[model samples]
Structures are given as structure tokens and as C-alpha cells.
Target: MKRQIVTLPLSLMRVTSIDWDIDWRGAPEAGLTDGNTQVVMNQVPRWVGHLDMTMRDDWLRSWRAHRWQAQGRVGIYRLYMFDPLGFNLQAIVGRAVAETGIPFATGERFSSGSGFSPNVYLEAAAAASAGDTYVTVTCTDADLVPAPGQIMSAGDWPMGVVSVEANGDDTYTLGIQMPLRADMAAGDLVSCMATGLFEVDDDLAGAAPYGKLNRSAFSVSFREVLNR
Candidate 1:
């Protein structure tokens, strides 16, 4: 079923932590007579992980305004999750080293350059299945290829790049950190910094009661919800 995507604005809460559960399954440790474990599977092990986030806030105003659509445990939650490798777009090759006036700054103001931001993305050279770990990137900037270990978002699915290889025909292949969770059609866009769905725990719906007025401290957690 198609789920309503709930995008949270930054005014709601500031992100503190994104702890990914990367404890993937592997061959069983069957002890051998010589004190060694042995097991095997035909298919190469694929990486799978659960995404998590801890957002702290006490803003009753924002929560009350959007709780009907944002808070859930049984439904799918589409959120603009920031990856660890946040905002790795085009390299700011030639720019003045003026620091951004985030939080507080007394010096000069920062300037973001013009034109479309340099993005390392391409149409799928070939279709990929859900369990596939790689896709052929085609017709994009060679100078903007995804680096190894960088996260790339295919629509709402974000996966890391495990490997990169140039096919010599302007089509580069990207090996994903985790196996693809859904099928990709030819010409699908793949890039970094996107949204995905999640599931919150039933018992831990919102916050734990409250303290004094005008201020409260608590964390809201989210678990990645994958498609079947």
C-alpha cells in the first residue's frame, strides 16, 4: 500500500545521533574438531542495516501542530533523514574560504555559489533487482562519480557505495554498501541526501509526560521500515 509521506521541518527538532544497526547475518559458527568454525552459503553475503535517529526537543507547539501525521508506530513514516556523509555534492573546487554564519558569526557572510549544485548521479544503465548490490551508472559527470563508502540515495532508498568501476563507455558501475531493497528501472535517478520510511515503537509513542512549563527534554526515535 502507498503510504502518506511525512516530511518534518528542521524547526521541529535538531538531530543529535543516527545510529545504524549494521549487525548483518552470516554463516553459523559451527565449531570444527580443530577449534575452527566452518560454514558456507552459495550467494555472497549482502549487507543489511537498520537506520535509527534520536531527535531531542521540548517544543510543544511544533509537536502539537503535526502530531496527527508525524507520530506513528503501525504506519510507514517517510522522513528526510540525513546520512552520516551529509551533503556530499559537487566539490567546491574554487571558492573563497569564508566560513558559514551558522549558529553565530561576527565576520563576513557566506555565499553559496550559483547554478545547479554538482551532483554525482546517473540514470540506471540497466535495470536492477531488489537483491542486487550494484547498478550501472550512465550519462553523468565523470568528475562527479560516487566515491567508495559514500552514500547514494535511489529515490527513498539510501545505500553506501562499496566499490566503483569505470566501464570505459561513460557508464560507471556502483557497488552499493547494502543490497538493493527494491527494483530499479532503467533511467532511475540515484544520488545522496533523500528520504525513506520508518516505524516508531508503539509503547514509546511521543514523549514521557512533561516537566516544568516552557521546557522539556526527551528524544524521539525512528526505525527504518523496509518494503517487502
Candidate 2:
């Protein structure tokens, strides 16, 4: 098999958080008739995060806007190293478009240890709760095993096993294995999410915030690949 590496710029990596619509109407409003209240059928924004990953240039170009299907396959791999506090890292495997640069089916296969901090986990969970589906995998520098945050138990906000099929003239099948949880099954739909925040610190003056804090800000990244 031919292999190529694609390095994604830190600006492209992102995490998106969607808000759950508790009520059919947008929000609680007084003096508004039931019919007049606008019902939002979709979720809204809650929080967002940005991340960075390096991959093959060819892979990045091929998956920029194309679509592909994916599925979960069983395999043994080592946990990659990540520095969530140091630098952002993650991994995923699935079928992607050859031309459109869109990923049809995708999910997290592994995550690095440093990538699985409490803040990172919470951010990922929030992304799932909103409506976005997709898991971020962080691979070791050697790419041998599951990285740091490999979910060993169920409670990892696991979505269902996702199967993606391309649309239009595209014909491809992709499967993604995700952390199994109580709220998810084998046929639920989900999207990949990334979130980022900026912080300012006096200790690291003139030092880049790639792994350190510099300012206080949050950003969200979102992409809908497949659902059910």
C-alpha cells in the first residue's frame, strides 16, 4: 500500500461544541403565543476549541472537500504520545474523498496520553453533547499503539459504531470504531469536532502559545461527516 504524510496546520485543527435544544422553541419568552415562538429543530453553538495536527500533504489535499465511507475494524496498536498542554495531537482513520476533500465516515481510533487531560475530555464530551460526532485520535511518534487517551472503559462518551457511504457518484465504504458508551449504539450518527482556546500569561513573555498559555479565548471547529 502506498503511504503519504499530511501535516495539518495548527489553524485547521478545531473542536466544536453544540448546545442541546431543551425546548422546541428557541428560548423561554414571555408574551409570545405558542405558534409564534420559533421552534429550533437543530442545536446551537456552545463552545469551540482549536487544535493542530501534522499529516501527509497528499492526504490533506485528497480529503479537503471530498466524501468517503468508513467503518470500525478491530486491530491492535500502541498508544501514541501527546502533549495537550504542550502541543495538540490526535488521530483518525476512515475513507475520504479523492477529489472533494470531504470525509464521509470518520472516528477516533487512538489518542495520546497527554491529549486525554480533564480539560480535553470535557471539551470532547461537550462537542458530542452538542450534536457534532467524531472522535480525535492521537498517535505516538512511532505510530505503533493507541496513543495516550485510548478509552479503555465505556464511559468515554462513546458514540455508536458509524458506517459511512459516499453520496452522488462516489462509491466507497468507511467504518470507524469508537468508544462504546451507554448513550450510544452501533448505528448512531456523529460528526468530528475540535475546539481551541487562547490564553495570555506573564510568565511566558514572547513565548509562542503553541503549548503554553498566552491569552484567554476560545474557538470552535466543526465538520459533519456522517450520522446514522
Candidate 3:
């Protein structure tokens, strides 16, 4: 897997909020161009994101020097936006081109700030044998058990968790959508997601801060390269 961990410009004191949009194009049925008669076909889904965070001067300086304005014109950079949430791409190209370069941002309030959807991960408490419908798992204080609707895998085979039953002591039985492809042993690795953000085709778009304040904030926008 080609991936890199990027620390935030600053450990965001607080993530005021994060917002994003997925756009689609609709073609009106052209027989008569009726306003209500349009087929809303989702085009290649493109994601645009915005983040608001409490910033630090050091981080702001770093952004200005490297990320926000690497060159006179903004340069492209890979952003691992959701590693904290485990939404990462398992495989990526080292030099995948981003779809767009950083565009300029107009900071309001001298304002700012910030920064994949991937398979999910579930912890294993106990192992299971072939033909067993339920599997046990040990949750790492930070880990969660496989939940219904998430596709999980042990070895190379993948199966969806259809149901989950909590049995106490951090142990849970996961009902897979399909029969096990092979027996899972205790301590086996299980996961439904790959790690890393979607590879981008172009450099990330850049935003420049308008004014300096004790606390900094700015917003950068970009499109993630799509991988299916």
C-alpha cells in the first residue's frame, strides 16, 4: 500500500466542524423538457470538503511554507484526511495525480481552516471454526466489534457481518452475511477496510490566510482521486 501519514498543520485544538458535498448531474427527459421529468443519474461521484479548526501559529506558518502555498502557485499534496476514523484506501499509487490543484480561498474573519470513505474494521475477541455463524472478538479499548452491514475479512476472503450480538466481557458474536470461507483462529487479523485516503490525481487546492490573529483559521479545498 502506498500511503503516508500527515500530521495536521497543528493538532487542531478543536475541529469546529467538517462539511462536504457529493455532486450529481441530471439530464431532463428531452421529449418536451419537462421540469419534473428528469433522470437524476449520479455521475462519477466527486467529493469536496471543508474543515474549520482552531489553529496554531507554528502550524499556520508550516501551511504557508509547504501546504497552503508550497510554491508561488499552490502545489499538490496527498491528504490522509480520515485516518483517525479508519476510512482509508488499502492501496494507493505513490505518485497518483490529483484531480485538481489548490484554488485560492478568501478568508473571512481573517479566517480559516482545514482539511476517504473506506471499508470498516472490527476487533476479534475469539476465533471461530468453519460452519460457525458467530465469531468472537477482543476489542482494543479503541477497537470496535464488527457490526451488521460491514464487510469483514480474515486472510483474503471477505464476508459481510449481518448481525452482531454482545455477550459481555467485550466479546461479541458476529453473524456473517455468508458462510465462512475458512476457519478463523484466535488472534487472527480481521478488517473490512483498507488503510489510507483516496489517491488524488492533482495537487490539493491551497487557501491563503488573509490576516494573522492570536488564533488562526483557514480553509483549503480539493477533490480526491477516485478509486473503486
How do the residues 153-190 of candidate 3 rate in per-residue lDDT, one tens digit apiece? 66534455678787777667778634565688787877
lDDT for each residue of candidate 1 in 1-228, tens digit (9 for 90 to 100):
555666554334334545443324556667889987786643433223233223323335445444566546545555544444544332333222211112223543223211221234567888999889888878556556667766666777767777889888978888985788789998898765445556666645555354455444455666666552
The CA lDDT at 54 in model 2 is 33
The candidate that wins on lDDT is: 1
Estimate, for each residue in 94-131, the C-alpha lDDT of model 2 and write its tens digit: 21211122322453321220112111221111122223
Against the reference, the lDDT scores of all candidates come to 0.55, 0.25, 0.46
Model 3 lDDT, full chain set: 0.46
Better of 1 and 2 by TM-score: 1
How many steric clashes between backbone atoms does each model show? 1, 68, 26
The C-alpha TM-scores of every prediction are 0.61, 0.20, 0.40
Candidate 2 at 96: error in angstroms? 22
Evaluation by lDDT, superior candidate among 2 and 3 = 3
State the RMSD for candidate 2: 17.8
The deviation in Å at residue 33 for candidate 1 is: 5.4
Candidate with the larger lDDT of 1 and 3: 1
